[model samples]
Target chain A: MALPGFLRRERIVARPGFNRWLIPPAALAVHLCIGQAYATSVYKAALVEDFGTSQTAIGIVFSIAIVMLGLSAALFGTWVDRNGPRAAMFTSACFWVSGFLVGGLGIETGQLWLLYLGYGVLGGIGLGIGYISPVSTLIKWFPDRPGLATGMAIMGFGGGALIASPLSRQLMSYYDPAYDGTAGTVPNGDAVAALFFTLGAVYLVFMMFGAFIVRVPAEGWRPDGFDPSTVKQKALVTTESVSAKNAVKTPQFWLLWTVLFCNVTAGIGILEQASPMIQDFFRTGDSSTVAATAAAGFVGVLSLFNMAGRFAWSTTSDFIGRKPIYMVYLGGGLVLYVLLATVGSSATWLFVLLAAVIISFYGGGFATIPAYLRDLFGTYQVGAIHGRLLTAWSAAGVAGPLIVNSVLDTQGEPGSLVAANYRPALFIMVGLLAVGFVANLLVRPVASKWHEPHSDAATTPTPARSAAR
Target chain B: MSTSVSKDPTPNGQQPVHTPAALIAFAWTLVGVPLAYGLYQTIKTASTLFTG
Candidate 1:
């Protein structure tokens, strides 16, 4: 006898390889586009020189962008769940491209507000949407390898800066002909305009590639060679399916949010002022000029670590469980921050090593969280949940820069960053990481109320239906 | 043709069901334009932010 309609639907859903290979390319495209955020620091000197703006004023642009990223993610996440990844990604691409075009025009015209509107508002929305597009889709497609899948995608996000940093620098050099061999002085006018227009065109193509390649697997799809029984073998958190609405109500979501917030804040503290921070730390009176150049390279090097950590540490979470991995991220990160605060300039190598490790954990936290959600919430509406969770990153992006820049600005030191000046901020980062560690420990298995059990008819076994196989 | 028929079985032990092209096209249409627009905006936003 033929199987029931529901059973047939379930079986069809279970079919594997709904374009698994497509996930990586989609993720890389999005990351490459969004990764431009990393290159913001490169433009800071130019902005300061051209418009004669203070670092604080320029810093506000990034802060606004970060805030908007979080806000837009929280707002659009629900729509993403309802409409699917394609819609969210598409919307992300539009806002991102528009933000660039407008911001470019603003630069040419010297309208700071227009720059804020384009880059901060429009670009921020793109960041949020593009950020979440491939995460949940990869998880669903690679249920047997959720950590690996999500890690690959998230790693792309971290590493995107590696490519973007160089590309932006090159573009700035090419466009800005008066590039005196200064570390942070690029004259801004038509050259800036041309650069913006070019990036806008290129990124539009890349982000659209990601959006086009994105596809939801037919429902209930599982890896072809995988067994559902293996869920019992893995130490990973694995929950039955839950809607995004219900997932948010659980304490686990809040705890994870705190963890992400803390991780991002700690990392941003170093990231936002890396060049200047290094220059200050290593300054020995007459050695300041050499120190500044070295500092820029240090900033670039951190980007490498940030990118590598996103893949290495997060991929490791597949074997060791997300909760435990996060424990290391937070706990180990706390100790590193303490070392940074206490050792000061005397322990220069230690400081660099510790900073690199902490930043990696920060990047890893972003890469791993999607898989973490997949384990705790199931694939039902993970994309939306991931989007909602990213608000924490948005918060951190603002808080991180504010803490670092505000502290330094108050000190009013234009030349170099002294060890004594950074102590308070280092301590704050340490405290944040400690709190995140506690939150990770508090995370419990998801309660049963959230599971969307497959409908009874869908779960029933077919009778003498060998023909369908 | 006989071999192919022998290897494949319809769910009801009869002819296979095929999803219509128009339905697929409609679904794509619902998603395609919005996605394209988002990409455009992302590029526009980033370029403007950095350049401006």
Candidate 2:
């Protein structure tokens, strides 16, 4: 469990006058690289064609990676906290880069399991670890603005797909002379494999940049002009720390979990079906009005909203408080889903507006959760608790699509279905959001029974000596 | 069981230390350019939703 000398948590503590501003970019470096997880759809058809397999088989590669992201984060959360961001980032880069290399090898040799093992398992571990690596450190560095700090980093995950999607397509086209990066032109497996190698090499430099530059704030470090007591005056902003082990035992944790699950589930319903859903909603008959290119554009617009909301809403949470923000995401989202189900087909613009805001809330929920946890639980062991809570995302990832897909299946076949067919699923999301609204309402500060003794008193240890332990 | 916020004075009094302006700008630019490019490309693609 001992990290090398340089990777040790003690080694990276900031000295006095160290610029806290430098930290966010470091966090973003890793996040933007791993955020490529969302870009898998770009090459999905190519993988399917080359592997001579069902879409579901290739889709499982992403599924396994997501599941592993949650599982590894939960398992490694404590170790990451016990070590530090630098070690966690280093470890994550290794697993992530290795996953690509191994996955590329699988593609060259025609082995699907190797793709699963490489990207799904190894890369997933990297995702989980990388996701939480900078969280607690960021919070400590920017206690006055936890929401803004975390948002800047987590937003990269949403934006990652934006970069990766276009990058992947261009890379594939370059690697394969026959593929023109146009519709129905699938790249060969060799090109896709080469694309993976290129991405792995590029991501290595960025992620390592993050690992080297990231620093934990020194002991007694607080931003100039910040008042901790001012933060404490807010409702549900706790100053006491809770160990991650006891965090699950608290009712607040489960409530936030449900809130997150419902928010994510509802958002994914639109996201999973964005392209087809828009076209289907606007369908006039067998032929629909919306063109395929426009539908692709709709998806792109949603991605923009998704990325923007992560930063906008989470930064807003800094002023408005975390609890009220969830009220907006869950409670407000309930109303939007209702509108999306009822009058969405009335016009294309209205439908896009509704879906864009809904997706933004989805992204906002993700960016805000860690700050929310910092509110209910103290900073101590927060990264681990955040890791544990991500299991909800893993659960929602499956549930969201299943709910929409199953409802759509019963309604009729894909591509031919009308807006009426989607009404049932949208209403179902409405109900889920209603449940999350209530869960958000019930969240209270962690009870005294769960607080670690002498929580704030433990902060006295000098960063190097304390973290080195 | 009650936890209160720590009101410790800043470790360094009177003056605050910051990373050099040039270094800060360099670091921000490192991550900002790619992010800006991605945003630009995505917006360009999204524009087709209205036009097409």
Candidate 3:
């Protein structure tokens, strides 16, 4: 029987003014704010001065925030799917703002625990929820353009830190002026507190924009001209929807997890220590020279590349397929890491170029994976699955910084960061990427058992289903 | 792919039909107001943190 006309109108109109172009920008607004997590390094100096804390201790704040982001995403992914993106984003805004306010209070009171609770726990919730809200919806809206759609959102995430780093530095400088006579001294903690509050407020507004604009396409709707068969032209792993519980049981999930972990770890290792690494590599005994500023600018330049690559490479995945693009990320990344280990200090530009490329892949990996999940698991439960997969990111966040920092810290002297200093870390990244490369190759098409065909008729096997027999 | 494979045939189809403007407005309020309020609180707190 044909469905009623009123029902059809209701269904068609539910799709609203939604188009592919709108989805990416909506995703970008939220992603850009969450991406500020990348800029935490820029604030390290300020934190150390204000709190009289060690670098390792401050690093824990980032670590906690990242872990919580994964955990919260896993916990809330189902709620997002049920209640929709608006609810999730609103919740995110609340937690994120409270985190900033609470963190500011902590800073003023010189209480490190509050800082952890505020920024790490509360803010992390915001990151996780905000991060996943737009992904599945955008994919559904642009089934034909999953890679491009998700990439646009994820690109904002990667580039967010590019804007944040400069903004944060400026805010820090404005609030905490350097004392002329005192080395490494910061002004009152009040300024820093004020800055955090301002950031929180601004982030809330941007995130709200994302929440307001985002809407899910009505069920079963494809773009007017798209053909689903074209999705197979790119990758072999595409499958119908699988529940999140089932997705976790599959080997593909684990393999993709490893891929994301290796990519993130390798990129973050370079990014976290970029400024200091450059200073140590090319120090010419002039502490106040233009070289120092130039090196910082170089780090900023890498940020731009990292940001652009998220959009560019991930969008390319639509054409070339996920597994092949990852081959480039792992294989090309390994070569770059090797070059850095063997001949990095020989020329500064080589190190910069290689680092920029690796970081881009790292950011690209994040931006691309939501679409990849949509391909592998189907859109039915992808948001939850994506949320669950983020546990890999939390793990990488810890592993990357640990490998880089522990190796460097163990070397003791600041000047000891010569080519030899990073040899072990670089090799470790290479080995990790190789492992990921193999894992990517092992991925196969999802099996029939995982597909969630609606209604019991799927199981009944009518003559239409049994015709081949 | 064989015709037996068939495209997804779930009710409402694969694409979402148009959402009522009222629903969009309602959804926007659900997300937007809290966020704006949060921002206001953040700004207020920041000013206090800096000035005080």
Candidate 4:
């Protein structure tokens, strides 16, 4: 299918002297908007009350969106690559905004399935497409510092929730004066619906601004003084191109996939039950010393670490190679989990510190993988390959929560469960991280057979390289 | 074979478009303010975990 003239890749190529710095903010715009997916808990209770549904039913809405994020990224990744960022961003904006509108209608009309269809399925597609659209472009423009460039953008994904959580609360409070987003004060359904519409409108403007301003670096463009030979010297940083099709055939892809799954699984073990897990861990007989307010604060602290780690650890990959970074994220993470499992309950500060670092590694794992893929697969079809790789995220999303939740369930009921009950689940995560550490250790360069036949560097050859030829 | 590409640095031969420093600052401000707001709010909320 042909893209419209305005959205064509060729139309948006940068002219000489165009600033590459503009691209990261454009990527941030889209990511910050879709990052709202993480803030659904703000209105989750209201949705449950409005529909008189189980918490599980309300929770499925988020699960479906996450599942769709993985699936659509896998499916539409190639189309995004073919059409370019503008078209993909525009398409994502349409779906994402429409999702809010449709979900609002569902809330107003009292239809749960409409919420699922609109927010889960439609909005999820937006998440997938929006996530990967700017990444490869950033990699292309910042080949000298791909990790830093990609990290700056993916950091926005972590930061989005930070913005959306508070913004949603304030907006909900504005719409319903009685609701203060406190423990007992759930916003009414209508207020929640209105909040969705307002967010959708605001996000559409930001995402469209991103789409309008975003441009691909022109072919053969390189920052004036960059030395590609310096990058070539980095271990496992491939100069050869590999198609998305062939990427799946390599063991390196699966190894990294395992690495990501374990990292995410361990992280989600903390994230999924962050609030309750803290309370449960510190429980003293019938009553826990930790207040609900404090638990909420714990979650907020974790978000800060998660966001900071995306930028910090991923940029650190530029100095230390990608493989070594994974060794830190997974290997160091192994010890963190054991500490979190064993002695975390001994002190409140100790517990919070361990969980925060674990979540940071989790966020770092996400931001660094794109650069790792660039290292092994080269830039050709990297976005597509990234989209495919997110399926591991979707899988781990389900598996992580299940492992923790089920273990907790078997141990005892939710409110009554104490620190000892969680040890099994935390130990399980420790094992998973050990598996991921080995997988990271096993990552080797893509074999020559997998390289595209025309695997010239994906960018145009330099004048010097051309002269040598 | 020498791979196919335009030897001309700017493919369309357009004049180099100089992006003003102010424009870059404005663009950064547009995204930065909101992110800053979020960080402030989260920090304020998270303060309770320690203080309480």
Model 2 whole-model lDDT (C-alpha atoms):
0.89
Candidate 2 chain A has its poorest 10 consecutive residues by lDDT at: A460-469
Q: Indicate the TM-score of model 3.
A: 0.82
The reply for model 3, stretches above 4 Å from the true place, is A1-13, A176-187, A237-239, A283-290, A456-469, B1-52
| Cα lDDT tens digits for candidate 2, A163-217 | 9999898899999989997787999999999999999999999999999999997
lDDT of 1 at A265: 93
Candidate topping TM-score: 4
Separately for all candidates shown, the number of backbone clashes (residues 3 or more apart, or on different chains) is 36, 0, 19, 0
**Residue A455 displacement (Å), model 1:** 2.0
Query: TM-score of chain B only, all predictions?
Result: 0.58, 0.64, 0.57, 0.73
Rank by DockQ, highest first.
Answer: 4, 2, 3, 1
What value does the lDDT take at residue A267 in candidate 4? 95
Candidate achieving higher TM-score, 2 or 3: 2
Candidate 3 clash total? 19
A162-202 in candidate 1: lDDT tens per residue? Answer: 55555666677788777743554675666666777888898
C-alpha RMSD (angstroms) for model 3: 9.1
Recovered fraction of real interface contacts per model = 0.00, 0.56, 0.05, 0.61
Off by over 4 Å in 4: A455-469, B1-12
lDDT of 2 at A458: 77
**Which is superior by lDDT, 2 or 3?**
2
